[model samples]
Target chain A: MGSRLPTGWRDVQVAARAVRLVLTRPAYATAAVVAAWASLTVFVLSGNIAMVRNLVVSGPLSPGDRLVLVREQYPFLGTNYGTLEGVAVLAVAALAGANLALVAYHLREHELSASEGGGSLVGVVLGVVGAGCAACGSALLVGVASLLGVSGLLLRFPFGGLELSALAVLALVVSTYWIAHGLRGGEVGGCPVDVGGRR
Target chain B: MKQTSRSDRERTAGVDDGRPARRGGREPEGGSRSRRRLLLALGGVSTIAVAGCLGNGGGEADGDEDAGSEGGNEDGGGEGADGETLESHPVGVDLAEKPRLGPDPFDAPATLVVLDDPSCPRCAAYHQGTVAELRESHVAAGELSIVYRPYPVVYDWGERAAHALEATVERDPEAFWPLLGYYFDEQSSFTSDTVLERTASWLTAETDLDAAGIVADAREETFADRIETTLEAGSAAGAGGVTPVSYTFVDGVFQSPINGSASTTAIETALQL
Candidate 1:
């Protein structure tokens, strides 16, 4: 096995290749996949919120009122996706998710190139943070605060009374630009050619 | 420089052999190892992303379970406790008995009962105009006790919201009309899905009642029956077909059921003012 890989330009070249692949024909394909994933993520997360609301306000669903598991997965979309407005929102959210997927993809690739194996590490951190925020119980909080007339006081602080709407925007931003600068500067930390031809 | 030299030699070796590095071509062992490592890293990152999504899904499902259990816990009052026994008090009216609004066998000279739905826009308009006027002019003066029996005919959501209004009677009888007025004032926001949110918010903000407790109670089918009994009462009195129907009673005798949005003048005339 080849060892003692140099910390330099060949890695940059490989990253450039990845970026070129991303920006060229593969860019469309990557974005399309990411967008589809992002949209589904939004739907699932929102659906969970709706499910909780139903349970809280209506108690256990009788067999007659039980929602179809598969059909209920998309929450708002599943309920109103046939409507024009619902379709429009889903389309917009998917576009935002696509942008996010691009940023995440590039970030992971760059981290993998580093000697420290930080790519997977970064992914773990992101997964924890993203899951926490996406599933935050801000809806109930805000609803309570609005009722209490203290929303201004409670929700103003960071992560104190955070809302789902803010978390969603943050998800869109992180996904769109986490590795934006790295991609633009044409940097890649690791490359296959960095290994000398030793088997 | 050493790495460059190694790469250069490898390229030369390939060229000398009359082959060039090509896409999908067999890689030397070290390059293959590097490709494998790279794929592993990508795989790990993708796995994390997938796990994060799944985690959110799981979290929400868990929350639903918790909320369901919580709701069940508060429903200890059984499923059929009609809130009728809860004593209701209007401003300046103090009696040991539950003060029946509109019409009752309370030995009162006259009772003006308004059958309205929380979801009815016309009822909302009447409440804002006629009902408010009545509250200030007759109710405050003790000339008449205007009782609002929810007709619940506008829609299913309207019935549920009316149940929430009835829920307030059990906890805060003083807030009964105020809660109904709040529902009427924000009438557009009351949907089957949104009734709980709206009720909880208003109760939390405007009343000292436990918002969650109210939600837990209102979610019970028993609480819904409280509103159902009132509906039955309205139907028995021949005032269930259309909402905003006013029934005037003089000395415990039913006079007439005035349908549609009757003006304060028409209502007063029906009350024999």
Candidate 2:
């Protein structure tokens, strides 16, 4: 039944609410779980992209050929992330984010229906923006780190944290949706009639 | 089925343990908008970033680096001997000085030209066989001059690569050979922003060229026309759409597409050896 939420610290709050909603609203959990599965598949495929290149098409190409492909396939990673390998990390982030959002939504809706107002709507918006900024910042840090060490270190671990954070964001989105749904119902004492639980 | 309502569809979409979660059909307008924007932005950034990383793995540099690891690799004088010489001094990204264009490199002692996609699988094989011969023997003798006009057909990264070649020829330490060697080196990393950035660093460190300028020149603005010309030229030469188009130009006349894919004996027989 939390009403007013704090400002600025949006990202952290979203993360907290997302985990809480995973229990009952299995709908959100299903989305998150599916996304997780997809993300893992992409990660594995990303790892094998190199071998696929060598064995299938573009086999044993020259350095020039290799460079050309990198530039075309991944534009954002080129400008940041320090190396081409960061593309895989980005994929993981997307899948994880979607999964968490679904799980959170289901939970939030359940709480709201049971007469608890749940997370504030403003909180969800702020959380999303904060997560985005953090993702960008993390990518920047990886590139800066390359300046200090042998640039190859970037090849080993690129902006993979984006994937992890994405899951948290997904969770938040799900939770927020459910909470709002519950609030519209009689879940909040003020509604008088059970709008959230009407169905 | 009577068309399911939007909310019902959404309910179905949000399946939990094979059951649709019930909702009051009262989605908050403002919250949904924000959520939508955030998701879109995240998806976009992820695609760009991921494409950049895998594309920059540096597989493209393997070939050229193997050849230009030493100064002897550049021993073949720029003079037109057998017309098969390949040099990297003209292809660096950091062009400290404008690349001196001698006679049309295509018109030199009559080495062959393969204006093909840097990432096509067939192109790699040609590099392995006859390209090796054209580069090592004839070019070393200075009897031939090889000109590489990269036409990126296999992927979008091809365009940036073509520009990078021009950049190397125009500015970097006459290390065109090193950059030229890189053409096939990082094919897998092509078209990815990360690979392009990595190439920027590699070009800077290896050739001591201006990395930033080259990147600026390649990116932000699309220099796709240059690639178009190469493609047009290849098509005009009657190169079948299939890649690894191998054709030699002896003196100034354009010869027919040669079979470089054949074994040495087949090529020797075709050459009437």
The DockQ leader among the candidates is 1
- On the 0 to 100 scale, the lDDT of residue B13 in model 2 is 40
For model 1, the superposed segments whose C-alpha errors exceed 4 Å read A1-199, B1-105
Q: Could you give the C-alpha RMSD of every candidate to the true structure, in order shown?
A: 18.2, 17.3
lDDT of each: 0.44, 0.40
- Tens digits of lDDT, candidate 1, B1-273: 012234323432321233322222232334434445656765776665444333322333222232222111111111111111212211112222222443333455656666677766557767787677776776666667676666565555777777676676777777787788788788776678888887898888888998787777777744666565665544433232345555555544444444334456545544555
Tens-place lDDT digits, model 2, residues B170-212 = 5652565566557567655555556568668888788667888
Model 1 gets an lDDT of 0.44
Error of 2 at A193 (Å): 62
Considering just chain B, what TM-score does every model have?
0.60, 0.53
Q: Provide DockQ values for all models, in the order shown.
A: 0.08, 0.05
